[model samples]
Target: MTRRPAPRPHPANRPPARAIASAIALSLALGAPCAQAGESPATYLARIAAIDDAGPELDAVIVTAPSAQSAPHHPGAPLDGLSVLIKDNIETADMPTTAGSLALAGNATGRDAPLVANLRRAGAVILGKTNLSEWANFRGERSSSGWSGVGGQTKNPYATDRSPCGSSSGSGAAVAAGLAWAAIGTETDGSITCPASVNGIVGFKPTVGLVSRHFIVPISASQDTAGPMATSVTDAARLLTAMAGPDPADPATAEAGAHAIDFTRGLATASLKGLRIGVLRRQSGTMPGVTALLDRALADMARAGAVIVDVDYTRDPAMGRDEGIVLHYEFREGINAYLASLPGHPAVRSLEDLIAFNKAHAKDEMRFYGQEDFLEAQGSTYTAAYRAARANSYRLAGPEGIDALLARDHLDVLVAPTAGPAWTIDPVNGDNFPGIGAGSLAAIAGYPHLTVPMGAIEGLPIGLSFMAGKWQDERVLKIGAAYERARTATLAVPRFKPWSPAPD
Candidate 1:
């Protein structure tokens, strides 16, 4: 037995360098698991915690509570051993759902949102809560994207000083930085996709009703939905599959069970072949770097057997004004309802209560921007004016917006740049997001939108968006997966570098 300690494994017996390298390359190419075998949830949390607030100082996480950490393994469950970060707005029994504001500091409901329960049932470890734009970026006009009173500013991992883009800023940054395998981010407008794009990750804003929004802090009931942000389309699709299902608490999800599909099923590189993809070229002009990347993406898709059709899709100018009206009406209605539904009395009981709390904590909450949007929303009423605005906004963004173009061109999906490169995080002037975004149409229409990493500009990542009609989530994910496969080689990984001024 003493002699049976066995000859200690030696470097001489190890596989050749070339052989080991080839094995790794093959594994990555085949999309095999890259994490070490039997990696513990604690191991992952430790790794992410090191970089989250200390190394790059991304400020992407609001809280990493002890209770959120998972124990050991659950091999039989769907997401066995996977770790997931929940956006701070999504209710978690163990952690506070701050929505990146000081007003809701101790608003721990001691209950999981329906979606979070689903994730837990599938064996996912709720790792922590990620920072978000305060009140999901609906608190003010010209507000900084990733700044929050509770979590400070979530920096873009690609460049420390660049905006991570909200309101899912931390969700996106955390996934992009490998903090967790995936994250849950809710989008009312561009909250999910914009941050996913700039952070160079796959963000899927599912059809509005496909995922239950029962416990999420609301921006708009008409458009808010929690989505999956992951490093790969396949992972995003998998997360979507687990999260999509009907919930009794949310009437909107009544049809979700019927519409939900195994999104990762039958995914192949040939998925793009013969598919008619209409290119949304109008929004590609503002950034030449982004335009160039988009042009290359179009060509690549064409070469991959996609029917490239140039479609002119112009958003109605009045849509924005109408959307503002609807959001304001809903924000006040939804936030009040959410506060009332909480089990314990929270610090801020209503939208007006929140406004006062911010006023009281001006030094922290109002350092950069005031709650103008909240003020405007508080004044809005759910009257005929609100109903009319909602109907008009939906009509313009749907039937007259994304729908018309797809129908005209007989296209399967519409493609556009998700957003421009990450902008500098300017607390004084706020977000200077210069490029066009395709999220508005799909967002207001309550349709599915998926953003996959396209490439980068000056080290800042950009994303290509694929969208389709309502409940066409599977189609969007499939097409996105195909494009991601083709462009995998060119996709850049994040380098936590600090931002620098442009050369003279």
Candidate 2:
């Protein structure tokens, strides 16, 4: 809820001239809720499916995620019946990983991505794939998140008019709307966390290499990693623990596996007691009503005996430019590798092919946005800028940022408002929200970051982020579980409606 301004003097007590101005100020201070209550998947899917027809057009999102078809039914597996929603870009044998574009619309992979394999090995059911921005929104500058030619647009369950906030839009919205128990989302920059934050769900972006990016579409191999999006931090940790490991297909896996740990053990409420947390004041000030919520959160932390150390932001030119350079170089390299792995796909086989297809199919692909980012990537080259930015990102978000603050302040973790309230979804102009994400440090550092539903803005929910340095997933999970227990908010689900009438 938005906060009210401090009370003003009584009209008779105050100077006559100031009465009108004070009233106006107070009225402006009260803002509307930015979020709406989300529905549970089991309840909402039937209704949603009725409003949204299920067919070939929207199948990619579901086909690529964990479904019964994708799972190995043998006994002894850990996640046997647990459903998973794979992002469209991740390869799945049963469905095409189109990256939401028509360029590879008819293409299908023969093998599952390493992460899906891991999910299956753990006994989870492969539910289906979730929709996402085409090419993870790297294809265009004005591209809308969650809009794709293959799956159309994924409407946010909270408000049909608001943007879902992502490249992982479908994954975030589906999980939050109760389409599944948990869904897998991949990120290059803010794809996973931003969507999770906006949707009021738990989002975890593991350290780079902690999860293999082998068959997943990439923007920058330097930063991209697959993580979990779920209803709670405990669920995210459970998924993360199952997915972490090495893959011979991805060299980055070596580093990740070495740092991987069973992140779900030692559940504790006392973990919050005496823990030191760095709060980045810069990340939380943009939205209305957020400060009050954060204040309450901080007070709760204090009562729990956690120490808060506020981090001061010093402008660093290098840090600002890292994500751009790294993504451009990686997009060019990653897309090419993914295409070659497809045995005999037609229509799109390379970035150039994707560009041509967009040009050829302007009415559908270019209906909302153009391929300017793809154009930019096409013209861009891997230069010293990329290497320099990579190093700076690692330094700033890692040792010089989170690690330095932790050691200096004797901290255990970090905290922030994940993102502000959900914004209205606009197809023509796209999303417009008042807040910024607070997960950049952990994301860029390749550490683990988790966001849980803190409270509602309007009727919609908002999230609070908890992050820790590499391999401290369990510590954060424990803290998150405690918060969930205290909050006791039930998750929402999508209500599916029937498509056609049937005779009895």
Candidate 3:
């Protein structure tokens, strides 16, 4: 994998010390707005360009330029010229789809992943690829999110010093910072929802088979699916409607097509009325503020005429354990195939090459964390132990966890605090968390999970999740929209500030 140079700021927006000095000097010479009162076009252009020259501190994660081919046709077009920052793992014929590793950095397949093709077909602009955790954060035990060999480290737009959450870190950060109107994010476990929750955006992890994963870098074919992260539920739904469908490349699409419904239509404010919503009480016990937010949300839902059922998720941790095993085995096999599919391929077709690559480039790749997860994955084959673990995960997350509650309580959706808050981004120590991922049950069970911005702690956003049974993408979207409509949080755009002056 080769690391590409970061996209340069357009000359008009370049903010170097020299440029800032020039602007300051010009502003003084021209007397600012007084001169602008009847300024000529050239003067106006110069002034505007000066302000535009402010650089983003974390431009490594945000794509400044978009693809001309994927640009929308009109202002109110279906996607309305909305820019989409695709996760590096999701292929876009127009941009490099490196799965956050140097191994696949030079392997840009000149074909859009089906989801991306559909996004363009719906008039969405293909913005640059967002950086992610190397190999979707499947690299090591203490790996930091949003850091990739090819893309460097993606800083959180909110705090600048906090974690953005992996492996969809860039996607979440870009959308939350208004770098793009919406973005395509892929999730295997907490990839999509976790980042979205921390970034304070709407992250929709559709039912396992709901969205096609034809050209995306695979983790586990069983659980990987491309979804949307947006500033609002409506925008996310709009993007999802365009991306969900069957693809000849992925047989999983066969199950997705029948379940693919127009996710944006008929978003009713009363969608939650008469619905049975279960609260995952066990998940947010550590975060009191998060629990309070959920309590207020639950009361709001009840006021809107919904039934709430309190649940204890501790009844089964075995399910998560099993799913972890399946992911490990599947990561090895699936990533191996993805590596082999590259044009001319890599000298290392298996995980062994990756290990060697990291070893050789420890200064660049292993600066943050070791690849213990990859080592574990390499050691684990699709043995009987793997099968038993995978089976138990599905059985427990399904029949015992989700289905049991749904059947007994007659539930329509399950609600919980998606995650606590954005932890400080520590390159030395890695992420800090309470070990509560409520969306995992939905993810491992192939169900739909939607996270909407609830509020923030210290200006960093948090999200409330609403998960529904399999093939219930529409229901989840509808309920999420209702909650979003009841309350809204607008995210701020990132002000560009170069990491430092250009090295001579």
lDDT of 2 at 314: 51
Q: Please report the TM-score between candidate 1 and the true structure.
A: 0.91
Per-residue accuracy of model 1 over 74-153 as CA lDDT, tens digit each: 68987887878899999988888888887888787989998998888888888888888988999887899988888888
TM-score of each: 0.91, 0.83, 0.86
Candidate 1, poorest ten consecutive residues by summed lDDT: 1-10
Candidate 3 residue-wise lDDT, 79-194, digit = tens: 75555667888877756666877776666578888888888787776756778877888888777778888777776655666778988988887666544566788898888999
Off by over 4 Å in 3: 1-13, 16-56, 59-66, 69-77, 268-270, 345-347, 488-504
User: Candidate 3, TM-score vs. the true structure?
Assistant: 0.86
Candidate 2 residue-wise lDDT, 75-179, digit = tens: 766555676778988887776677777777767777789888888788776666788877887877666778888777776655555667788998887665555
* Clash counts for all predictions: 0, 51, 9
All models, RMSD in angstroms: 8.1, 13.0, 7.4
Off by over 4 Å in 2: 1-76, 268-270, 314-317, 433-435, 486-504
Ranking by TM-score: 1, 3, 2
Best by TM-score: 1
TM-score of 2: 0.83
lDDT of 1 at 34: 25
